[model samples]
Target: MASTTLRLPGLGWALLSLLLAALFSSCCLASASPVMNGPPTTWLSAPVPAEDTAQLRVFLPSPEARDQFLWRLAGAGVSADLTTLGFCSSRCVDLLVPEVDRQAVEAALPADAVLRTAERNLGGRLRAERDRLAGDAHRTDFSGVTRASDFFEDFRTYAQIEAFMDSLLAAYPEALSGFVSGRTFEGRPIRSMVLSVGGNSTVVDAGRRSIHLQAGQHAREWLSPPTLLYILSGFLEETSGSANLPLRDLLSQFDIYITPVVNVDGYLHTWKGDRLWRKNRRVNSGSNFLGVDLNRNWGPNSTWCTEGSSTFPGSDVYCGTEAFSEPETQAMSQLLDSLPNVALAIDYHTYGPMILYPLQHTYDPAEGDDAAHFDHLATVMADAIRAVHGQEYEPMPGSQLYPHSGGLIDYAYYTRRIPAFTVELRGDGFIVPPSNILESGEENYRGLIDILPLL
Candidate 1:
């Protein structure tokens, strides 16, 4: 038997060839494209090349020494990103420096100033970790009622958070109250919730002193909102008779106001576009960078463009043109002003397990009269937190953490004269693994419970 040969028409053959060429081109492009999961791509495209950078944990005896070294680094035209702030003299700061200038940085340091390698190939590591976490997040099931695990399993997107909030309100209508405080710069509503026995009716109770709790001021701290949600969940349980009587008694006396995510625009950006976007999405005039660190935009004692903040738009700690320039900050400040009595306030952040009080602008305590009281409160809260996870959370003045000019805790205490504190939750930096969420939530809840009596 002889096999017959097949032939196609000229036009058909040309079309087939074109299709094959297109397929080959597509594959080539896919292979050539860089992997883009992880920290904001904008960060990698910063002035210094990310591949040639190394993250160093510099240990110094004092904050002054660290500042002096940083000044020297800046003078040498070396770019350094401050990743973590500490409270004591022997504080270790994580700084990303170009590999080319690593030797110069080491040489510029004093004899006692030691540098330890934290991360090499910073962009690559961040991308790999992000991709891994994203993959794990895809495996989560969000079908029925969200369990305690669901909130802590992985970082939720903005839509997921909104959905969770809706479910929460629907589940416990009497114990939780929800509202829109104000709109963000990007037109997103800044949602808030009140935990009280009467829910919505709590607003009418003029005698009730309110306690405000806020998180997500910096968008990259994905763990902040969930931790607050965890605390909220405990409050709900107390109202439902599942928790202890003491908790119920404490919760009933005051309305607990919680803003889960303050930087709504930036939080969305972290979920959809970049995993490490930190500031609110506010466009700056004549600058390619777009955002202002909400934490640095508060007023009444705002030392803008000073230490712990930057005037340059590209800097991570970029303070806005003026105090309360960002709409998110404006909305929050207004809310605080409108409340008849805000006895206690807490601004939650992440990456450092510390409880910080006022006077962030300077090392000196501005509220000298209330200094002892603040310390006692912080100590009690810290002890409560440590009981759960055995994690030692340093309780100190915010200024000891770093020389931050404008901060929420400072504004709340100084301008409003309300007792406020900043709780910096600890994990693997900003991106805490889902496994640690529940423990963090539980520990923080214990701390809050201890704090209520004082409030």
Candidate 2:
């Protein structure tokens, strides 16, 4: 019999115990880290509601100050809930900044500053903002959709998106089948739908070519999801005797799946609190701030920060704590597992008009690899789409466009062996406006039509 003796001095045991405690605590921390240095700006003196410890309300002097301040805050780890912004020859913006940085933020501003953390009546200010928007100060309504767009179900909320989905399904019941993909960290329902002429009969019974298209992984990219929605609407429309006849014919050939919004909680936060909420709402401690970049949560290439992302959990480009840590991301991962035959997958994003293929998540070229076949297919699709719209969409590997890692499109192509691309929808490279919705939607519809025939 062999006997081994293990001994630990009192101090050694204490250190070991402490290390164990830390390991346990980190597990409880939210998955994902932000890139901000030090504590996030806090409003030390603002009177907050009992139920809301993290409420923020900024009242700036001139509308110009509001825009500048909001941009600065967003640039410096502070998120702004913008109420109004526009251009009347020039741009003006009205916003509310989080209370976390109230004192330091105020002290840095001009003494005659209009920016304020507290006013005589907080509730009344909210009421006035609500009423102003209710009257359509910025002309928020969409032409094709009749419903009034507002904060609760704002122009880009999950509810409005789902309503639009319902409309698409109604128009093509035989071709559409809806599924609850999963739920957000905040428990909002993440929904998805499939569009196909043969429907489940084709996809389930025999082998069928499939394409998965998803958009709005980043909440602030409002233009991303709309293009997908428009494309779905066009594909399923019964254009019995119109120019869309070819598009109608393509829908019959391939099964198309769509996810309008991946980060529902963050999108809702954008409508209710901040217009630039770009991550999923995952709570963390030691600080009242939290969220993760859903686009950076794919499992294949974890820890690929420092290229186009950050490790400090407070930064806008924060990659999650670990790959697939997000339920929404995991849901998409599962869907891919179930639909392994997907010939092509697209994760749409925005503010940059381009069609990019793998490897965004890695610098390794897809030039001579087996993925070369899919890469060639992507070139064909990109060229065909651009020809129809006359919109110059550069077709290149992600590394060529921008160096990034752990992105969905990269994972789909490199790991799952499926051809995938990430389409950065129209925004003229960031100057998005509500009026451009229909035009952008139509362009995306045309692009999708051109690609569908090739697929």
Candidate 3:
């Protein structure tokens, strides 16, 4: 824990880490190129009005195409966001390009790169998505959850989300205990609910292992909170009614900790300010940027701001001024340290049907995380998810998706020695349809419970 705290390394260690990285992390050289610091990874924040932006799903033919596109973007001075919390693949990524620059971005790409506009008007899509998710949020019988299908029919505001948790707490007092993890940058309480058959202390007294499921590190991924809430509702249900035997067994023996939203300020901002906001509400000193990307503000790892993140305050993937610079991440890391025994940690995200495991900052295999065991668990989880709705979820290392430094999963895995993972939910646009929330949660519930017996 001492070594893993949110403190920068001394010059000696920092240089040593680089040397060792140069020696063995060659596999991730392309991804780890500090691309974010320069104009290549920077999308220049787009030139057009923010609301006029459109999303492009670019299919790169090869690594060369990807590189050329980045350089082309830089040379053309065209803004093409290739990756971020944005969905990415071995040769494909989704980008948000300005309406005027679409043709320029398209021309910058190689002939082989297949670029398709995912959303014609990102702002209009979000506005409509908000309206749709706001449907029938008020119900006559909203006193308490009579059945597991009580809520999640629509997206909820921060207040509504908290109210939903309170309802669950009141309904299952014996099984649920609510606590404030900490305050966010905006002074909002970051809350969590622990689910155990008898209660939290009982789980501790029994020496039960805990698995934490959290979502909403990025603000605009609106489906994440409710999806996680869906999972929470499923697990906290009476075991007698659940045909999910593994979940029953899990509840009988393990503690389930659920945090529906980690970036409270960002989420609140999404509701009140920009519907597409991505970072926490932190006004950087001497800069116009008003937030720091919480996902990239984690850890003091060797890869801190090297790749997959930016030093610029305006960048979407900005890593903050330093590791754990934001209160949200500090709160999250505090929560991680408070857990007596964490068997696994999974941070959920939106717009991807993928299960990602750690050693995320590098392409190298983890020395002690038992790659085979991790693979097996991820494989089974993916299968279970697919079985539910005939939708596929690829299980792979996060680095293979894209090198992300200072990521929460990397911090949880490399520092705490916990088996950490990230699940990207439903690879649709961030403005996911409301109807899909319950179904995605159900499928993910299957994926999660399937691995409990094995854990």
Candidate 4:
């Protein structure tokens, strides 16, 4: 038998090398555990009682302190629910620790730390609110409404949202357009809608100015998508009716693109399995960990594995293997890149009642008139939101909340040079009841209307 030898081209050898490197990297990442780098500190040695079940609010003086505490908690294998209100500020966090871990956590705190609230049944209160909302939803009557397009009484499922988008396109064939902007890791379509008064435009027209509104980047923020839908409905009504001349004029001048849900897989997961899932469902190659925080997966100024985000695969704010690693984020980046005339972009989040501007990775002001413009627009939007329900929303730099990296709004402003805002709607936390859905939509709609004039 002739000696069997395989001859390979230089490109083939290079490909083989890349494959080996990838395999090695994956193996290393799979076996590597996330380590806490800070100096070790003393912890409470007493065993926690089973009945000591209540959440506590521990306030740290600074972000550094808060981060240190988080690392400590992680190291101790203690679970914590970190709130965003005082994130990067001196009033640095509402840490919800399990009853068993409360003593240990409280003891681990620095002397200057303040206990804002004693252990309370916050979970029970939230559950009660949800139950009440569900009861109200059952009692709601849709007898007079003829079309599915008119349904907006409660929060909708992913299927319902998609169906609603379809109905909008069917109802307004001439003015509204829909497309699968991208797909999630689980192959779910990331749907988007465009509202151009007078005619339907499938492609982005460079000559026409536009504003992009996106929501539901995080799975648990169910209030966001409905708010976007409400805004879309308002635009549709304007296109059909003679009323709201100002809104009609605004619509005529600018095409509005709305992406109701960016993380479809995670959103569905919330409904089907876990209610608090916050990231996109992306399986890590080496580990069994699933999901990547899409907000922490953008580029240019992405401070990966730092401050607000984490290098650990299991973290809630995991930035992913690399910037724009998730297809959802990549699709969004592409969408923004394709639209040159996008003057304003808003990424809606929840529970903070905040209108945050760019530079989330740092406190440094943006170049030229960018900072001024962001501040003006943010203040205008916040004021408009406040006028609706007398609910005051803070309008400030995103860094004021936390030193976040790779956020969508930050990417839009810093890299794309488009003015952007991250609107955290409603103050009732992530689980806003169905009763507040309509009000949240209306309040956000009012704020959105104010945004157009500034744009």
Candidate 5:
């Protein structure tokens, strides 16, 4: 462990630069020893344990080079998670690499790609963050506590996020209500929060259109779950004049359903096991991998594992053994099916800082009305996001980014005819700073609502 990370070869000078630039880094990283000790147990070498994997920032020259880079990693028996791989710039991405495989992984990079350490000690960082979990927001004997004192200032556990939702339901019974949509594989409830005029979303009103928004589909995306929670908070605050947004009119015409955490088991695992886990905790039939990427578990049946999804259980982009195979994905799919007139659906994810639309399962852009509608609305939404803090969010068809099939947006658009979207939130990685919670939520919330009235 480097006593101080101050620019030595492979010393994570790049990551250290970010730590120095961030405001909270001074306090949290006062001692600044983000490293762990490991001893070889094999004769030659062994794969780095997943928990100890290091994050690498790789810059590829073009999108084609990105696919080739993934293939190179796959050839070297390495798995890359496409779902949350941060696309920080036009050609830059962040990936997790095992310490033992660093040399081989570097050898596997595209000829023109540039690689640098993003986070050299992932396990140490997660441990340090967990120690700070005492985080002042506890709801005791429960009178009125919506979130932790620093809810917007820190990323929280799934339990705390659930408690926050339940507290809001009790606090504003007339406007907010919820139900357990389904239980996860581990028997944890996948709760859905509803915001409507009368707090009843089980049945859609005669003239109302429904909107579904969810985050935490990929467990490692800690920023997403809280972003949705903050958005929900903004809506609640509006009723009391504490925050002002044009929600009353939107509520009049739409029944909004928000699910903060869908991958309950995997999310809990991140807190106690691996912080970079990107799947639902599913025990595969004969494989060592114990999870399935829920985002890649959606279905059109025929196109389930066709393109960007993987047939291999160990791959980060692995589409489940079968589409909608995981309990969490099934629960969400059914929830969307139940919405009588679902007008739009947004599956929130992280690190691209972009907005994406349908035609994801193939290499073709949406053809007609869907194309125009998606393009226009996505551009408008991206502009709305930039207005908040000048963070640019590119809007494009999902296939352009990557041909990910069985994605939630595709399921909603192709099968249900609902205008679906995916908002890849601000930041370069899953371990986004806690201070980003409020702004990420605010920009995305504003971008979303700004387009609602237009629809």
Candidate 6:
């Protein structure tokens, strides 16, 4: 064999190349941990050292106690992938915590306390950054609407949002068509809107191509419901005598149904008390226990309390005592199942800037290419969003994100066969600057337009 050797680049060029590579890698890593810029919607946990342990979990007295603990812990230096469990008391804290953090964190806690710990999941760093940003609440310039739209003023209370919805209906009697689907356990209305293209047809009776969109499914994902409301305003506001032209066109092709603030009670809680509250305000059976994670309340009976959920009613990912126990989730479930033609569905959340497709409630992969419908659509939509607003997002299967079972996206796809996606929006935090709200929504709004046309 002839002796041959490749020459190295010049010192300067080599250094430059290394620097660029490092910068790119840094950007990618940062992207992986989407930043939060508002208040948290759930409680924090105990503090831990970074890059020290592979996993960490804390023993929470109850789900609510866990929330408060996690919030405080996040404020401290510790973060971990959460696996909310029901039966963890002081004695069994070791069962959940990573072997490394178990002894240290447990020693720091009360002797008789239960345990909370991290699973072998990689969500800790991301959760910390997101939570940090979420805690940075501020005000920003209003840039959501092009023309002079007055909807952007003070942060709307639950009462204000309802008043706005009511006004829309009253102002455009014929234009408004929809249902107050059901009430939250706390008696809050789960309002849904219908922009009927063919005038007077029930959404459940809609055809196979009918489109479904929802926002504010996770009460603490603050960017979602407001963006939805803004989009609704755009649809109703007649610009140049063609106000809803684009939206009207969309409605003509498919029945447009939007539900903002599905978890009305939780949404209100975010506004009123804790900005990080994730569960619905449903009173648990005994004691002063309160709330259930409505998002995890949709598992089929057979798959309840699997992964991606907690059996504890107080955990943020808590699956309810039973599937569909929350009236809000139940109402949506009935409506989705009744509508044979729900070709597409979106359950919007924020603080990740990722588009998540189905198969959440189960680890079983799809049987065929049919499952690719959501995956492909999500990519297209995310790309479209980036192009319009210069925002970036990742599109991936729901399982890749957290691998939870009994999620809304899973039920929509596996059970109903509707191509659904759960969109995780991002910002500093849930109480994000009012100014950023419109811009964030605009980016997503454009993305929605891109995907809606294809559907």
**Superposition TM-score, candidate 1 onto the true structure:** 0.82
Better of 1 and 3 by lDDT: 3
Global lDDT of model 2 = 0.55
Q: Where does the lowest 10-residue lDDT sum fall in candidate 1?
A: 36-45
| Residue-wise C-alpha lDDT for candidate 4, range 91-119, written one tens digit per residue | 45544454655666666688887776543
lDDT of 6 by residue, 56-148 (tens): 434545434443343333333222322222222211222223334344444545444554334343235434534554433342323333324
Give lDDT tens digits, candidate 1, residues 411-448.
88876777788898976355445767788888999998
Model 3 pairs whose backbones collide: 351-427, 352-427
Better of 3 and 6 by lDDT: 3
C-alpha TM-score for every candidate? 0.82, 0.65, 0.85, 0.80, 0.82, 0.67
Number of clashes recorded per candidate: 0, 18, 2, 0, 1, 59
**lDDT winner, 2 or 5:** 5
**By summed lDDT, which 10 consecutive residues of candidate 6 come out lowest?**
1-10
Would you list the rank order by TM-score, best first? 3, 1, 5, 4, 6, 2
Worst 10 residues of 5 by lDDT: 36-45
Supply candidate 3's per-residue lDDT for 278: 79
Positional deviation of residue 81's Cα in model 3 after best superposition, in angstroms = 9.8
Predict model 1's lDDT versus the native: 0.69
RMSD (Å) per prediction: 13.9, 12.7, 7.8, 10.6, 11.0, 17.0
> Which candidate has the top score in TM-score?
3
lDDT of 5 by residue, 162-266 (tens): 777777787777667788889898889999978775345445575788889999888888899888887777767664442444576565577888899999897
Where does candidate 1 clash, by residue pair? Answer: none
Q: 310-407, model 2: which lDDT tens digit per residue? A: 44454445566677878889988788767746777888887546677777755677646645765666666566656655665556676554355667
lDDT of residue 44 for candidate 4: 16
